[model samples]
Target: MARIDTNVKSIRYPVPCDEKLTLLARKLKRTKRQLFIEMVDYFYRSKKDPADMNDEMLKSDLSRIGNRLVGFFRTQESELLVPIHGMAQELVGNTETVKDELKSIHEKQGDAEKLLRENTKHASEQIRLLTSIFDGLAKMEEMRAGFRRIMEGYIAEREALGWSTSSGKKDELVRRFRLKVDRL
Candidate 1:
């Protein structure tokens, strides 16, 4: 009796005598079963009729797909890439403007700080000069007070002794004045 193999099943299909299917399978480095499965899947996925796919039809289909890809790229470039490029340029320009403004502000700040320092220095010098002038004036006032007091004391002493404080002769006063003027 012949043994039955439970793990295998078989079906038969007819083909032309030229063996084109076998040749295509060998050229594509796939088994006949794998080739048939792939072909069936491709037809199902693409929804294309194999009977309509001659060389000219294939070329026309590829050209149409190529034109669609080109259009999609052009749309994306116009809608996305071109605007992004313009925005990038505008951003760079804004950055440069901000930098220039910052630099100008920094320079102005430095100048203002320098001017404040110079003004402070000038104010301090003026304060010192005023202080010196006030000190000199205070000393001169003290000296004038002292001289007035001494002159009053001398006049009182001379009056108590019944003598004239300004008893110098006219000739003596004139000689004294002439001597002082000569010294000057």
Candidate 2:
């Protein structure tokens, strides 16, 4: 024979409450009325402001957090030491020095990179300036060559016309031809 749950009374709700009642009753491993009694008791206790209770709750929470942190560090310490256990003690002793040296090397490498960039910028500017100078020289050479060609052509034409190449006549011809060629 099954036991009967007697002495039940009706409970009312503004909204659907059957699901919540079933869940709470199942979780507490009790009848619906027992769960209701506990709920009512908690509701009256919670009528006090929670802000005051939170301070105490926060302290407990922090104490639990600290315990967890200590446990975490203990586990991590064992894990970290496992890999290094086989290494020679000499290397372990020098580990801090090696770390310092590596840090210094990294700092020097950064400085060297900055210096290299500065030097490269200076080199690029110098190359540009040199290129400009070379271009100017090339233009001047082209102009000089053009003037020589004009003089040579005038001499050839004058000689073909059976003209004299006397010193005084040569000077006068050069002066007149050069002035005419310069404008063009």
lDDT of candidate 1 vs native?
0.79
Candidate 2, which segments miss by more than 4 Å at Cα?
A: 1-95, 164-176, 180-184
Question: lDDT tens digits, residues 1-184, model 1?
Answer: 9999774755566776227889999999998878888999998887777877465656889999999999999999999999999999999999999999999999999999999999999999999999999999998897677666655765565556453435554445446545644443
- Cα lDDT tens digits, model 2, 1-184, are 9998776778677445778778878988999878878877875775544347566656777899999999998887788765567565767768978999999999999999999999999999999999999999998898778778788888786786565557777777778788867864
What C-alpha lDDT values do all the predictions have? 0.79, 0.80
For model 2, the local distance difference test gives 0.80
- In model 1, residue pairs whose N, Cα or C atoms come closer than 3 Å (at least 3 residues apart or on different chains), thus clashing, are none
- Scored against the true structure, residue 66 in model 2 reaches a CA lDDT of 100
Candidate 1 regions off by >4 Å?
A: 1-71, 164-184
| TM-score, predicted candidate 1 vs. hidden true structure | 0.51
